[model samples]
Target: MIKKAVIPAAGFGTRFLPATKAVPKEMLPIVDKPNLQYIIEEAINSGIEDIIIVTGRNKKAMEDHFDRSVELELLLEKTNKHELLNTVEQISNLVDIHYVRQKEPLGLGHAILCTKKFIGNEPFAVLLPDDIIDNEEPALKQMVNHYNDVQSSILGVKEVPHNDVDKYGIVEIEKSSTSLYPIKGVVEKPAVDVAPSNLAIVGRYILTPEIFDKLENVKPDAKGEIQLTDAIESLRFDQSIYACALEGTRYDVGDKFGFLQATFDFAMKREELHEPLKKYLKEKLEE
Candidate 1:
């Protein structure tokens, strides 16, 4: 059973710009809660017990969110705000949260590699905070449940348009079933003329212990940092890689325009804010 998950949060969200200079991109507000909270909630809902977050410098606010704020709790208790208390308490109740400093802004592969001591010999999960899936079936859980049956490394993949394939890690599928497929190999940002398929690997993975060894020998290719996709490719022959296109609408919050769209959609999901938000957006459109 995949009971552990590692979320890499050390990336410099340059796309978000000056705002992100002080604020961590993962902590950006979605609707009622911060963005990282949603991702953390997803991990907790998926029955993941040990949640490891690989964070870096100036990211102390991320840790503080998970940690208990004693004074704030007492203030809420005094005011008899049961709802607020319950909401604040949910953070602690969610999971056994652990933090490991990535030390430097390496790469996603290095972030996962840092959790070796905590992971030990178990199959762990890696979720990218940038990819937020809106669905009843959590993306990681979907992949892990499938991995439980197959007992092989599984990646959360979704079909993209032919042109957009170059923007992501495109999977070369050997065979295809309904929701799952046997991925032959993956090409990171392949050119349009020589592209394989439209299926792109998203931000979810259930990887075995072999990946750790592969990551150790995996050099920083052309990119200065270790890429996880490279390590994933090296494990191809030894094990089969199954791609599961999860039943969810993925919003790439990392993109500027996508982030704006997500903010509007997520706000519309809120009961109190829906009508008002729509009205305001309509008014703005008219202006």
Candidate 2:
């Protein structure tokens, strides 16, 4: 069984600019909870017990957020805030969380490669926390369950507009069934005319151990960082790779506009924030 998950959280949030100067992007709060927590929760819910978080220099705050807060727990207990206390306590107890420093802002492939010893020849999942997926079933759960059945390296794919295919890694797949497709190959952000299909690879992956060998020899791009797409393409030469079309709305929270959309969408779904947010939106529209 795929019992472990690796989260690559070492990136410098250059997109968010000055705000991210002091904070890790993964630590940014979507509402009340840090974004990384949601990803951890998703992994735990998908039956993944061990989690390896690849972090970097200024990500100490992210670590602290998941650690036990004795002082805060005492204060909440003394105030008789049982619900809030339970919430805070659950953060640390969620899974067997471990941290490894990526040491540099190499790339997603390098961040994942750092966890090789931890993974130790086992199939594992990699989740990019920046992609917040809203679905009836957790996105990773769908992919994990699919992986369990197929026993192959699987990627989470979602159909994108033809024009937008250039913005993501596009998968050339052969449909095996209605929901699953075998990824023959993948092209990272190909030109519109060159893209094989509009099915874009997203942030979730169930990767096999053989990927580490490909990553070790994967050539770096002009930016001198090993791209995960390159390694995956190489891994395709040896093993079967499947792409499962995701049944959910994905928010690329790494982008400002996508972040705002996710915030508004999630907030509107909450009973406490729904009416107020709706009323505020109506007022703004009228103005």
lDDT to native, each model: 0.87, 0.90
| TM-score per model over all chains | 0.96, 0.97
What is the TM-score of candidate 2?
A: 0.97
How many clashes in each candidate?
A: 0, 0
Model 1 segments more than 4 A misplaced: none
| Cα shift from native, residue 51, model 1 (Å) | 0.8
Worst 10 residues of 2 by lDDT: 175-184
Task: Tell me the tens digit of each residue's lDDT in model 2 across 174-232.
Answer: 96756889888999899999899999988999999999998899998888898899999
Winner by lDDT: 2
Give me the displacement of residue 105 in model 1, in angstroms. 2.3
